[model samples]
Target: MAARLPALRHRDFRALWIGSACSSISLWTLLLGNAWIVYKLSDSSLWVGVSTFASMSPYLVAPLGGMVADRAERRILVRVTRLATFGVTITLTLLALANVIEVWMVVSLAFVQGIIRSVEIPSDQALLANVVPISDLGNAVALTSTTQHGSRAAGPLLAGPLLATIGVEGAYGISALFALLAFASVRRVSVSSRGGVTRLRDVGENMREGMVYIGRTPEVAAIFILVFAHCSLTMSFDAMLPGFAETRLHSPSGGFTIMTFGVGVGALVGTFVLAMTTGARRGPLLLGTALASGISPMLMAGSHHVPHAAVGAILMGSSQAMFMALSAVLLQEVVPDHIRGRVMSLYLMSAGGVMAFMNLGFGAMADRTGAPILFFLPGAAFVVITLASIATGPYLRRIYRTGTAVAVAPAA
Candidate 1:
């Protein structure tokens, strides 16, 4: 079992894994709580989009966050920022329990958390690279994502009970508890850098360097483009799910919880399978997952019941998890350590930015055209783009066929 899951053998990686799992669970639950509250308050899909948008809009400054990670002790930054978030979340929980919380307050809290995430995310990514050797990075990435996607099931699973019984305020309280756990869990991570204060150089130059390097590296550019398109068109459906659950499925919070939790279960199962493979030479599998990612949403488009929609959610989760992990492993293998944090930040920024803004548009579109169109159209566009990537780029096609586009992860 250790051989199959090499990353878990590392003590530090285990700590980071636990922290990330808790953090992800907190995020998904808080997001569900926030979106549900917004929907109840405004009764509009567009407002739900705004609530979701607040959760990721801070990625607009991802480069700065990246620079911070590169210049500082990545784990320390993550812990410190996580602590700050814990303080804020606790206060918010108190407010919610007092029955004084409002829609704007929830959205505003999400934005604050999002801003912190813009910094903490890159730090965690960089820190993982530091803790695990390159030979294990692929498995490490896969496993880390496993926690993220898998814990989504836990998040929404917890949310359903909490929301049904104690209300969204109770959801906020549980989310805060997770935040505190995230802060405590990372205390064991050893620092690797002297930190930003000592290594500090010209911030503007560093930021520009990260961008210029991506522009110069065609493979990285292509990957970022693909991630952006995939996230914006196919995966940025959090905003539309409210309308989809309430209007289309007619089950409200129950359907919403099932859909989100199913994604987590499928993602957990899919990425865990990939992690157990013991190598990165699975490009054909990656292509298949990417295609499945698009097709899954299309399946959701026709679903009229909870069970059917749950199946689609599972497929979407599994496919997206594999595709994302494979792409991340490939990028990590190629990018040098000097700028790893910056590049990783920008890479996620590519996904987050588009997803953030487009969520607003998706919400409005879901309102005007019905939630089903939101599902069908983005899936169709993603399929067209995925096919176009194969048609237009011989290099990309080769990666798919050989699975050797990146250095193979070592078999333990």
Candidate 2:
């Protein structure tokens, strides 16, 4: 197994992977907890969107976070950032237990969580490369991305039962517990990645260098565009899940948990398969899954029963998760270590930052036109984009044929 999964051969990477899995649980639970709390308080899907927006908008500042990651001791940054996450979750738990948690308060706390995540993610991504040898970097990244994203389904699934049984306060408290566990796991990692000292004044130049590097690398740039569109169109729909649950599925028990679980199950399978698979067929798999990503949402939009919605959710989750993890793996392979954190920040911005605003837009539209069109239109547009790319975009087509990240940039 160690030979098969090379990244798992490293003790620190193993520990870090376990730590990140726990952190994924906490972050996802917090997101769903905040969404449910905000929805309950305001009874408005729009405000639920606001909650998502607040939590993810911090990715806009992630480049600064990336700068910090590159300059500081990355191991310490991972430990400290996750520790701060525990603190934030505990505060939410305390406030909710007091019965004083308002929608505004939830939104505000989510923003704080977002800020911590902005710093946490870049450090985490940059740190992944340090723990494993270059030979294992691809598997390390695939596994990390899978754990961070594919396992995210566990969050909403965990929250579903907790929210049903113990209330959002209990959910928040459990999330904090997991966050603390995550902190503990990562604290045991020994490596300290301290690059050259980069002062605050040099941030602009550093940022520009990262941007320039990306511009020069067309493969990375294309993946960035694809990830941005995926997040904005498909991933942003999470904020609308409450409405999607209550109105569309018509499940008597409020099918939010079940729906998310289905998505989680599919995502787990999708990402795990990609992570575990060997070379060849990856290009076809990536392209096929991306195309399916569009179709799945339309299935959800057209669903008339819980079972149908679950099937759609499963498909949606699998397709989207596969595409995200593969794209991340591609980026990791091609990027040089010097600017890895900065480039990764832009990737975060594409996913989280773009989702933040798109959530707001989707939420507003959900109230006006209901969730069907919200799902259908984006799925349709993405389908069109996919077809166009296949037809004319030779770079993307080459990626589809070779199953590798082409055009690796030179070291700075």
**Which one is best on TM-score?**
2
Model 1 ranges off by over 4 Å: 194-201, 278-280, 404-412
lDDT of the candidates, in the order given: 0.83, 0.85
Model 1 scores what on Cα lDDT?
Answer: 0.83
Every model: Cα RMSD to truth: 3.2, 1.4
lDDT for position 97 in model 1: 86
TM-score of each: 0.95, 0.97
**lDDT by residue for model 1 (1-412), tens:** 8888888888999999999988888888788888888898889999999988888899988878888888887888989988977876787778878888888887888899899999998889888887888899888988988888788788888878888788888887878889889888999877474233234478777776677777777666777888888888788889988789998899998999899889889999998888876443577876788788888899999999999999999998999888888788777777767777888889878988788999989998888999888888889888888889899976577777766454422111
Screening candidate 2 with a backbone cut-off below 3 angstroms (N, C-alpha, C), the clashing residue pairs are none
What lDDT is reached at residue 312 by model 2?
Answer: 89
Cα error of candidate 1 at position 220, Å: 1.6
Q: Where does the lowest 10-residue lDDT sum fall in candidate 1?
A: 403-412
